[model samples]
Target: MAGHSKWANIKRQKAVVDAKRGKTFTQLSRAIILAARNGVPDPSGNFQLRTAIEKAKAAGIPNDNIERAIAKGAGTFSGDNHSLEEIRYEGYGPCGVAILIEALTDNRNRTAADLRVAFSKNGGNLGETGCVSWMFDQKGVCIVQGVVDEDQLLEASLEGGAESYEMTEEETAEVVTEVANLEILNQTLKDKGFQVTDAELRWIPSNNVEVTDSDQARSLLKLIDTLESLDDVQNVTSNFDMSEQLLSVSVV
Candidate 1:
């Protein structure tokens, strides 16, 4: 398995635990608000909002919280006058690993300062825009886990408009599709009785940088974790790869 996939699995497991602590809910609410802000509040009419709501529901978020977030984004609620904007930060971590961070923030200066500190303190340096973004392509990725035949899932995903599908070493199916068809493909797979685990659009690196030294791997993971812990940070992607053995020993 690729290192990023391994890290993704770890993050997914951590998300479940975080959900109980309300951290995941906070992030999900931000995502919901951002999606609603960019499109209609009704999920049926806005694909991004629909995807965000689905993700929140999967994480066990309450319907009331989701509704309130939508209302706040749609201007139905006057609780706050803050406006959010999306920002992408590019940088290089330990061992020259390319990192891309996506954030939604009401204050850009604070976000930038937080990120700069995170990178500088963790053996990384923030770079100019497009520094590492060109190495990544925006695509839709859907992960499904359950007892199912790989061939059957692959066939269904392809038929549902997936560009590619593969089974990860951990037995999860990863389906890739064009960003525009993510929702349609997700529904098709779900309708076919597949238990979808995660579906979203993300920046996927074209190639991965292998991390052989344990210390470098540890530093890289720490950097990514710090960035994710930020209140405004939504997603972080890196091009680091490590052996399963090293990852098990180095990552906590």
Candidate 2:
């Protein structure tokens, strides 16, 4: 869990950089669309939609764009008829580190081809579905920032049905719960005056492969970056662990 906690912290920093470059807008909009399409368009009535909208707002997305995405998802906007479907892809990276990807795509063949190329070009290979998925479990994660009392957070989490909570960084804490209890735990934290910033479902690897070789570390990171660069990829998860020092040098 600590390895994943470290990875999550790095991702948070990367997201800030990505947002400044306007690279997160497309992904954020797609999330809003999918949330709205799966449930009600109104954020107040739909937890997923509300979470997506909050993420978009945090990324500095314009209200108009957010509304347009919702309209498209609800099939109320004129001439926008594209339907997106969520799919999961599995593969192996350097050192047999299992990798799992979640994507939202309108064309499966195109997305598959794009992923195949991304993997093959970066020292990995796209494998059949379920090949690596079995190594992980899906859990809901809620991130809270600012200094917080560990005891208080633990109590609140327990009351909200959270399974575990940990401080992933000096000022950031992550609370994990069952998929169905995510909404409850998020609201509970907010009610307790915690500054909850993000909430989403994440694949948690049951086991991890440690990468000490610098070359293998570089290849793994490159494979992950390449996979994430694809427009259709929503999330990429892998079961690799490396030291922060190695990670810093391996980001080629």
Candidate 3:
């Protein structure tokens, strides 16, 4: 594992634990609501909504809750009037590592205040828009599970329009593609008999800062964890890499 993939693995593990506790249900529901509100409520007609529904289901969110969220998003449910806005916050972490945060919030001021506190307390600073965004590129990523034949996968990736592919782990492969080609790539891999477990748009770092110091690694991980713990936050990406040993102990 390296850089984005390493952090993604950790986040995936954390998501499982969070799902078990039902902690991710709120975020998942919010995502569903936002996706529905932004487009048609029918997943078949709306790709973002479909993706949100898939993620919600994978997180163990009940079908009833998902339906209610869609209703709320479509403005058919009169009980809720909260209008959520998607916002991206960029910043610098310990050792000048770039960090990007995606959040869904009803209160921008509150979210910003919370993020500022998290950053300042963790040796980081919340930066202005586009401050660190230049260091990253938003790309579509799909996580294919199970051991796969490299030759076959390579052929499928090429035919599917994937930009590149990497084996993040022995049984896990990460496929990258343009945003427009994600759906095609996902289906292509599935048709080719690959188990596509996860797919989403992500901010990938163009460069990674090597953190050799254990203290910096700990601080960076703490900062990211704190940011992710926020209710309004949806995702966090950073341009930092560290040794596995340092990463293990750093993420208490």
Candidate 4:
């Protein structure tokens, strides 16, 4: 999962920018609403809703906004009839890298057009559904930062039924667990005095496509950034790897 760590690092950086632009709250709100709409509004009774709320709280989202989103999604608010649809798109980016996009949009056509344009402008093309999705596996990922002890985190993760874990050079511990155990593992880590930076269900690639060329790597990153900037897009996952040098130089 070499590419996974690199992508995670880049995402961490982009998240800061997103938060600065006030887009983080909007995205978190959508996630909460979708989670609530699919399951119980009470986080304690809904695993997905609980995870969404935890992530929103970690991101410093206001409690009132979160509550309002949950109420709106649960159909408790009058005149709140907005219907949201979840869609997945598969594609190939530069260097034959397989890409998966998860979007929540009310208008599928507009989102599709925006994604297609972004792909075309960045030397990529959207593919048929399931084209690249089969190359990924869904798993729960929890990232903890801020001076965490790797050994302690590993021990806690093991006790919490985590599948595996690794400490990145940036002093972040990424723990992988089954989708059903995400909340447990996250709570376990938090109880162990680890500050969880991010935790959610994610699609992890089975293998990585190595992009040795700097230009190709740059284009791939740009394509992903553009796609993620779209309001409808929620998450973008790809199977691409590059040297740390290239990653540093390619940051836009």
**Span of ten consecutive residues with least summed lDDT in model 4:** 16-25
Tell me how many residue pairs clash in candidate 4. Answer: 0
Instruction: Quote the lDDT for 215 in model 2.
Output: 90
Return the TM-score for each candidate structure: 0.95, 0.95, 0.96, 0.92
For model 3, how does the per-residue alpha-carbon lDDT over 1-252 read when each residue is reduced to its tens digit?
565567779888877766434548878898889889989999998887898999888877889999999998898887787988999999999999999999999999999999999999999999999999999998998899885588888898899999999998888899999998888998899999999998889888899988888888888888998998889998999989787777878776
The residue pairs found clashing in candidate 1 are none
Tens digit per residue, CA lDDT, model 1, 130-204: 999999999899888883588878777987899987677556878999998998898899998998877889888
TM-score for model 4? 0.92
Q: Can you write out model 4's per-residue Cα lDDT over 28-88, one digit (the tens) per residue?
A: 8899999999998999998788878987887888899899989988988778767888999
Q: What is the C-alpha lDDT of each candidate?
A: 0.88, 0.87, 0.88, 0.85
Q: Residue by residue across 68-119, what tens digits does model 2's lDDT show?
A: 9999889898988688899999999888889999999999999999999988
TM-score of 3: 0.96
Q: Candidate 3 — which residues are off by over 4 angstroms?
A: 19-22
Lowest-scoring 10 consecutive residues by lDDT in candidate 2?
Answer: 1-10
C-alpha positional error of residue 21 in candidate 1 after TM-score superposition, expressed in Å: 2.7
